[model samples]
Target chain A: MARSTYTLTIPSSTRFLEDARQFVETHAQEAEFADTAVEQFKIAVDEACTNIIEHAYKGNEDHHIDITIIIDTDRFTVRIRDEGESFDPTSYKEPNLMELAKKRRAGGFGVHIMRRLMDRVEYRTRGNVNEVRLTKFRNAEHRRNGDQA
Target chain B: MSNFSVGFRSSNSIKVLDLQGELDAHTASELEAAIQKCQDEQHYHIIVNGRNLQYISSAGLGVFMAYIEEVREQGGDIKIAALQPKVFNVFDLLGFPMLFDIVETEEEALSKFHDAHEEG
Candidate 1:
């Protein structure tokens, strides 16, 4: 159960990604999360939003990305909800770095970064909305291994 | 706010780009345009100085990936230098260190260009 939950909504545009990251940074810092965890959460949220703007909304910039920050006794989570296109998790493949560079591709790295930084990354379809939930836990094992990524 | 910009600094034949402010999806296009301009002007040996770069996302990294092959194929390289630890961590997270010439100082990046020139 969450002890506290905060929400932020931004226009579905890449220009607003920094605001989303700043919101995460302030709340995560106030929560006294470890520095590494705070950084991870920020990047994860940014990537999630970037994916939504580019892939989900397809750069339409007319939609909204609803962000909910859930802080519990044991975990900190960022749930990003968007009304854009639904993502197919099964289609996600870990990108080959060299292959992408060789092909002159500039994307296909955001989801991978989100999955590595957060302890859990979940996708859900509720009615017409699409949500990608990213969570990082407070634990000794996590603290020890989280930095490995 | 996005608030990102790139400034150009030239050292001999090398073009050094000073990157500042947040770098994400919208602002990444600015970086891409700067690089594109460099390519257009036939300046291929490039160094990105990120001392003032406050943040980055995968879209920002993607710009580098998109330009790297073309730059290298032209017998030039993109050397990244002086990134803030946090900014560099994003690059590291995506395994950029292996595919990029990342150095701790602008001098090192410049020296790399010098070394290549001397080798020629």
Candidate 2:
């Protein structure tokens, strides 16, 4: 008997990470997600938000990103849209750790971690808009008992 | 997706644990359970080799803090080495350098352990 959604718009900066964390934490608590599950959900969402702010905005500090969080009976989904140039996350390949170390790069690990932590991650671009969708199941049964083959 | 992974390897009385992949809230539990299992088995004197670690969130740091406290209570020590710059930045920002003994290489950690042993 749950059908509620919350919306939040904030600057594309790491300073907004607290707001994004609160958004996920609130919905997960409402959905009765286990504390561990809620934690993962928050971490993943924060990474996504950070990615938008850092990569899409390119540290401009002027662009604003819109993030929407929707909570259902068994799942929580966060959708982020930015007015920056279109980009595709699906094309992002997980870099080899050895190579990254050799190059002495500290970035690019954010997207890779997001994909590993979230239940579902999708990216699409349409008409000068870049969108990334993240979804996570709240119920343990839905998560452990769900189809995975 | 575990927050951390620990393995005990003996290189002349120095124990080394290789930590790989992301260490965050989602995966930190696996690390906790694994560490608890090790404690249950009475394995102590730990070194975390983070050569393969890609990212670590605040929750991940919490996991390390909890384990370090437990180890200390039992008269053992925990050390860290090979942290990437970004991951190290997170640790440094959180003031971990003051709380934990962090080294740059596995050999250095072992040498420091030797010094501690001799001093004690």
Q: TM-score of chain B, per candidate? A: 0.98, 0.86
Q: What's model 1's interface RMSD, roughly to a tenth of an angstrom?
A: 0.9
Q: Which stretches of candidate 2 lie over 4 Å from their true place?
A: A139-147, B1-120
> Which predicted model would earn the best TM-score?
1
How large is the interface RMSD of candidate 2?
A: 11.1
After the best TM-score superposition of candidate 2, give how far the Cα of residue B1 lies from its true spot, in angstroms.
31
TM-score per candidate, in order?
A: 0.95, 0.57
At residue A89, candidate 2 shows an lDDT of 67
Error of 1 at B83 (Å): 1.2
Instruction: Give the alpha carbon lDDT tens digit for every residue of B11-114 in model 2.
Output: 66446778777775455666677667667867667778888887677556666666776677777777889898767866665556876888888888888888
Deviation in angstroms for A112 in model 1?
0.5
Candidate 1 residue pairs that clash:
none
Error of 1 at A56 (Å): 1.5
lDDT of 1 by residue, B59-116 (tens): 8899999999999999999999999998898899889999999999999999989999
Instruction: Write down the RMSD of all candidates, one decimal each.
Output: 2.3, 12.9
